[model samples]
Target: MNIYAIIETGGKQLRVESGRFYDIRHFASLKSQNLSSNTKILIYRVLLICNEATISLGQPWLKNAIIKGRILHSHLENKITVYKMNSKKKTRCKFGHRQNSTRFVVDSISLNGKEL
Candidate 1:
């Protein structure tokens, strides 16, 4: 049966499927752990999951439901220009920002105490 799950990470909710890759925001403190690009990680905050015709929902987060994934890579996002200008004051400020993000590949989904 085809299975998928919704997980929360980096203050965002994402719909993920097994064997697929997604780019997500990086954790601030994870850099201290010296995580490699191929590191495997388990995310336990599953919000919802659907297996074939059956669905399970969590009241915030599901117990015993987890998403296993691997870190494919990490990179910075495209730079965005922030421009602030005043019409009469003749003040113009410009800045560039780039966000750090990580690429993750979902390996498996475990639900109801079993891996699917």
Candidate 2:
């Protein structure tokens, strides 16, 4: 069995596994610094983690849990169209929006006093 963790990011919960890549909402300001493909970051908002038979849960977030990952790239999310119409009032509105997001590759997961 493999170890996995549940994390909260971008107002959503995601189940992430080690050595994999996932897309998450962008929260960093990269306007002043240059980024490379190997730049690493730490994610600390771990809610839960299960390793085979042992399970760890946090009231809100684990105090000493950390997930190490590297930024893969940043891109715009898919455009979503919102349409509103009224039959008798003759009102119509259409709008489209695209959200900024980033991709990260998980490197490792560690906990306080233990390593997995």
Candidate 3:
């Protein structure tokens, strides 16, 4: 049976799948010359594993609800523009920035959405 589950990371929830690259959070700055060094990593812990049939819809939880994923790359994102302006005041400033993040994929989701 096909399995799909929701997992949380970096103050966000991600819908993941196997062999599919996704963006994640990277707290550290990347300064390496290699292109791969700038990417953020996203990895999941095997907390719980379960199947849809085993999920407790009304109850607290099933016997074992698993969540799992893995970090792939830590990379930079597109630069965003920041602008400040006043209607009549002679004050203006502009800046651009790129956020950092790691990539990950849902390897496999079993009963608890963890690897088999």
TM-score of each: 0.91, 0.84, 0.61
Q: Residue 65 of candidate 1: its Cα lDDT?
A: 95
Which segments of candidate 2 are over 4 A away from where they belong? Answer: 28-36
lDDT of 2 by residue, 15-97 (tens): 99999999977634343143456678878889999988889999999989998888888788999999999999999999999
The TM-score obtained by model 1 is 0.91
Task: Give lDDT: candidate 1, residue 72.
Answer: 84
Candidate 1 Cα errors over 4 Å, as ranges: none
Query: What's the true lDDT of residue 109 in model 3?
Result: 58
Q: What pairs collide in candidate 2?
A: none
lDDT by residue (tens digit), candidate 1, 35-109: 578887889889999999889999999998988888888888999999999999999999999998888899999
Q: Candidate 2: worst 10 consecutive residues by lDDT?
A: 27-36
State which candidate has the highest TM-score: 1
lDDT preference between candidates 2 and 3, better one: 2
Model 3 lDDT per residue over 1-116, tens place: 44455555556655555556677664232333332633333334322233445532313233344544455566778889999988799899999989876665655555534454
lDDT by candidate, in order shown: 0.86, 0.83, 0.51
Off by over 4 Å in 3: 27-64, 112-116
Which prediction has the highest lDDT against the true structure?
1
The RMSD (Cα, Å) of candidate 3 is 5.6
Count of residue pairs whose backbone atoms collide, per candidate: 0, 0, 20
